[model samples]
Target: MAVSLDMLSLLPDPLLIIIISLLPFKEAIRTSVFSKSWCNNKLFKLTTNIEFNELFFVKSYQPSIKHLQRKAFLDFITFWIDNNKESIIEKFSLKLSMPNNVSELTEKCIAFATHKGGVKHLELDFSDPKWVEYNNVAPYHKFHEPMFALPKHVYDELKGIQILKLYSCRFVEKDLLNFHALKEVSFGWMEVSIFLINSLISNCKMLESLSLKRCWNFSEFYLRDRNQKLKKLVVDNCSFQYELFRVVAPNLKFFKYSGMMSYFDIKGCPQVEVADLDFSTEFGFGGKGYRLYNFMEDFYSLKVLTVCSYFLQVIPHGSDMLRMERNFNIRHLTIKTQLNKSDYRGIVFMLRSCPMLQCLTIQLGCARIWPNYAQPFASAPKNFWTENVRIYECLKSSLEVLEVKGFQGFDKSEIRMLAYFIQSGKVLKKMTINMEKDIILSCNRNLDLNPRKFAEFLLKVPRASTDLEITIC
Candidate 1:
């Protein structure tokens, strides 16, 4: 033990600091008691990255003493900051539930983090886990706890931050400032208005990615910047105040949205290659299928597209507007659905639309059923795939790779769907099927069903491509 301690003390100061930085903040501080050299050397004080998570300090089995815990946490942070005052912090992340009166401490910490223009990545998550659990359905703005309002003066010092993420925090439009060096920004569970969003985009000229999740208080979102450097945009479960959402970022490459259906008039985004749309709708709200069609048609340069079961359920069937001659440039298409009767027409429509599709992935599973959605899991018709099914254009030409996930042998609809693909895919080269054992047992109620036998049965099906290969797992 003496020799080990001597060797540890012999390690270079920079190497010791690097080792200490890998540990949690609390554990790193505890190294002071390991030896006299650790205390005198102050390796923990030299760490460039400081992260404090309340869960690390408060054990799950401990009695809840909110006031005492808060004080201890804050005091520990103050002590660390005092010791590391001269150190250049590259990243500062604090995840804790803040009381309404703790704004001063929060501001102080923010000031220290940006004191010398050193921090490049910063995250401040003040959301209380208990609040999220109790009011899971309500928006963050409706929570009883007051959100931490960002101090206006802090914005002036954030010019050096390249990545910023804030959760359950408040931001005033007037407090917005130019983050010239910022490359990515994420805001969740807050109320962001159109003015605030527009101002952020205009100010952060170097911004490349922006994400907003579970945010409310503004409806009309219009982003129209031609020279923008944005490449990825994600809008998840945000409540829009209007029916129309427009975007015109010419350099965007990836876009993802999950919310209720609306008229998305995305223009000038010729560089978008990947898009994921997860739209939810109730029974009475299923009439806006044309809007989805029109929205999908706008992605002229889309190379990959992903959609949920609800997206298929809402697409209009046999409508003249839906039949308007349009084709997509998508080369890869992924559909997540439960393979129900109502999804048949939509699946066919999507296959027909993607004429250049080279790869198709069908995820056979049930998604989260939103509220007021009636009969979202109804079984497919007995002869749905067999009746009047014609080989689509892509199935005969461009489609070469097919992948099916969550496959169960007993489901007749799933079997027929695979059979249809095997017979129609002229150029198909590789087919992969991932079996779900739990689902198979639950649906069949018999343990004797062998998945290998099912794979063998599929091998007997007629194939249009003589070079096709099949693998099941």
Candidate 2:
């Protein structure tokens, strides 16, 4: 142990600071006892992303314990914030369950991080302690809102602010708010006015990414930028009240939307490389639905695409769509939907369109691995893959990697699809199959599925490519 400590002490100061920064607030502070080398004031300077959470230390909401924990957390935070005085901080995060009246301390902490210290990223989460159990239904959880009053003194300090994330917070739009260096901003479970949202975007000239999740009290969202530098945008579960949803970003490289849009119009985004659309009934495509097809008709620059089951239901199958339009540049594809015999056609239809696809990922129901853009939520098992002979006409020449999750190994449609790919992909290099034993057992309750036996069966299947690598999990 002493030798290990000596080795750690020999690490460069910058590396040591980074190592301490990633640890929890208390754990990071305790490292001072590890060695004299770790006790330098530089450790305090390295404390950039400071985070404090009272609930993490307190087991229950007992008034006495809660009070004590809050006091201790406040003192600890104040000490560090002051210790790092006149220094620049990369991030400062806090999670609290305090009453709205006592929010002065929270504001003070923010002021210290932003006003005194140059904080580039700030995150404040004051939602319900048990917010994980809440639903998207009307009358959502109502946690006390921390009114973030960005007075001139506080707003001016945000010149270096690149990322700002807030949860269950409130803000009143004052004057022209300008975060010149802001690049990414996200607001979740917050009530923000449409005017304020537009104003915020208009000021962030260098903004590259923006996400609004479950933000309420908005009837319409209009996103139009002639000099836009945004590369990624996500608007998920936002309640626009089925009103107008407009976007006209010319430089957007990635776009994702999931919500109800009564009147939707998207134009001028010719640089978009990837797009994910989750459509629902409230999307308002009454009759003149052909316009929807026309909208996507010119996505020749799109290299990757992921569409939900509802999107597949609307678009017709066959090579006609591909034949009529310019050849797509799509080299990677992902589809998320329920798959039985009935939905197999949807997968086949989508595959026929992507002739240059090099990678394919399919996620069904609970088996969803993450959509590559967003952070993954759960550990996804890896199982069945490949396409049928028809896929040979489109993807066999270019498709190199195939990944499938939540494979039950019972559906003949799925097996045929997998067999076709394995036998037809002449250029395929690697294939991954993630199977769930529970799903197989649910299909065949009387018999258990043996992963090893299944692997043996797959190994026996003939492959078109001699160097094909297969992985089953």
Candidate closest to the true structure, highest TM-score = 2
Q: Tens-digit lDDT track for model 1 on 194-300?
A: 67777777887888898987777676878766447889999887777786788888899999987767678887787899999876433333456567667766787
Query: Which residue pairs clash in candidate 1?
Result: 219-241
Worst 10 residues of 2 by lDDT: 372-381
Q: lDDT (0-100) at residue 185 of candidate 2?
A: 83
Model 1 regions lying over 4 Å from their true place: 1-87, 98-112, 130-146, 151-153, 281-283, 318-324, 367-380, 408-410, 435-449, 466-473
Clashes of each: 1, 6
The local distance difference test score of model 2 is 0.65
Each model's lDDT comes to: 0.75, 0.65
Tell me, by lDDT, which candidate is best: 1
Q: Write the per-residue lDDT of candidate 2 for residues 134-226, one digit (tens) a residue.
A: 322222334334444433455666667788887776654563256667788888777777777666667777788888876777767787664
